[model samples]
Target: MHVPDGFINAPVSAAAGVVAAGAVAVSLRGARKELDERTAPLAGLVAAFVFAVQMLNFPVAAGTSGHLLGGALAAILVGPYTGVLCIAVVLLMQGVLFADGGLTALGVNITDMAVVTVVVAYALFRGLVLVLPRKRGSVTVASFVAALVSVPAAAIAFTAIYAIGGTTDVPLGKVFTAMAGVHVLIGIGEAVITMLTVGAVIAVRPDLVHGARGLSAPLKLRVNGELVDAAPAAAPAATPVAARSPKKIWISGVVTALLLAGFVSFYASASPDGLEKVAADQGIDAKAEPHAAADSPLADYGVKDISDARLSGGLAGVIGVGATLAVGSGAFWAVRRRRHTDAGARA
Candidate 1:
């Protein structure tokens, strides 16, 4: 959920901004380790996919709705560090391009939505995976539980932010209860989507999944009567052919993102999302100013002159998907390039 400009006061917002900046800085350094050829492509795809899937809002309560937070899903699919980077990129694009989230509240949104959710959910996911069975099924189960918990955790984070920097006289208790209640329902939807998506990727190319590393069992051999696990072998060297085919996965992922955002978003519910509804009901929106970029031609996901609601939204979604892919791909590729350079230097 995006925290708009008016919800949090300047001081608190600025502080959150500092925290968010520090988080991004740390993630940038950490992501270099996670952004090899296999994961760099997937990281960009994760951002584009998160952008696309966020269009479909599921009803959380009678009036409020929620969309994919994407933290748990991304963390599970990629790794925790890269997952933070992916969601950060999506938030950056949505704020600047669509004005979906406020620029002033960028830090609030990233800290609450991107950082907290990714860190909390991923930690829980790893812990559960460690305690649970070692099968692939356990991975999906842990993902489900982790995602389910992460949404309300994000809602709680919002309430705390509001408590610190709320612009209105709304009761903190009410805000917490309402937000937590609604987001809990939303968490169910998040869990299902996160598990399904994670499960799909894990099924097809488990090796490509960052979290799946070290989970593969060795080939088994029978010696006489006793059975033993075969010794693990070194991974094959990267081939030039493999490098070219990497583009294919990126292409396919971008196409899927385009279809989801550009066309499918038209069917999205017209109701306001979680933060908007909460602000309206709680009267925390009094000081909320219109977005600085609200006047942008592409503001509110509409073309400047488009009349048809469906067509305007569709075009905006397409533009968003394209921009997200380009920006996200460039970011991850740069990280990967730096990693390669570092490796060569070490050699």
Candidate 2:
């Protein structure tokens, strides 16, 4: 849910900005350890994928729709720290280029959508994976549950933030109920999307999926007082096959993302999202401010002066994907480079 400007007062928004900045700083440091040659490039692709999927809003209720919040999917595919950066990059691109999320409320959006969701979802995912059977299916199940919970968690977070800095006089209890209720439905959509995407990645390149790393290569077990490998004897012969280059998957994923955004997005439900529906119903948006980039060529996910709805939206989506990929890849590359440099200095 992208909080627009004026929904929260200046003081609280500024505080959120500080919190968002701090979280990003922390994530960047943590991501140094999370990203390597293999995963760093994939992080950018993850961001672009998230951006693309978010545009395909599925209807949740009569007048409400929801899209992928993407915290769980990103964290499961990459690392939690890198997931935060991926989402943050998408939010930045949406705010500045697409004029979708509010510029002034960017911090609040990031805190609720990126920081809170990633932390909660990843923690739950890790916890479940530990207790469940160590298999690919377990990862998929954990992803579904984590993503299901993360949406409401984010809704609760937004309610908390609104309680502190709400611009309207709406009853806090009603706001909480409405926000949570609608978001719960939205959570189902998020869970489904996250599960499908996570499952797809795990099937192709489990190695690239940070959460699925050890699941494919089963651990040895001691049977009848003797230690034995869990895998069958012939399994060792498949090493070369499984060791295929990631380039194919990477390119295919990017192409799929482009297709989803540039073409498939045209048919997405047009209903207002969970947050927007709640804001309108609860009067939370009574004082909502116009976006600063309202006149931008790509405002409202359409190219300016483009008469064809399909062409306008398609062009905007493509631009968004391209921009998110560039920014996200550049940021991750920098982090990866710094990590190598630091390692060298230590050595």
Question: Of the candidates shown, which would achieve the greatest TM-score relative to the real structure?
Answer: 2
Residue-level lDDT tens digits of model 1 in 1-347: 89888889899999999999999989988999888877888898999999999988877677677899999998888888889889999999999988888899999999988999999999999998888866788889999999999999999999999988899999899899878888888999999999998888777667676666676567889999888999878978776875545566667778888888888888877787777787788787888878878988888888889999888988998988888888988999998898888889999
> Which lDDT values do the candidates have, in the order given?
0.87, 0.93
Candidate 1, after superposition: displacement of residue 169 in Å? Answer: 1.1
List TM-scores for all candidates, in order.
0.92, 0.95
Candidate closest to the true structure, highest lDDT: 2
Candidate 2 lDDT, 1-347, residue by residue in tens: 99999999999999999999999999999999999988988999999999999999999999999999998899888899999999999999999988888899999999999999999999999999999998999999999999999999999999999999999999999999999999999999999999998899888878788988766554689999988778655544445543577777878889999999999999999999999999998899999999999999999999999999999999999999999989999999999999999999999
Clashes per model (N, Cα, C within 3 A):
0, 0
| Residue pairs whose backbone atoms clash in candidate 2 | none
Clashing pairs in 1: none
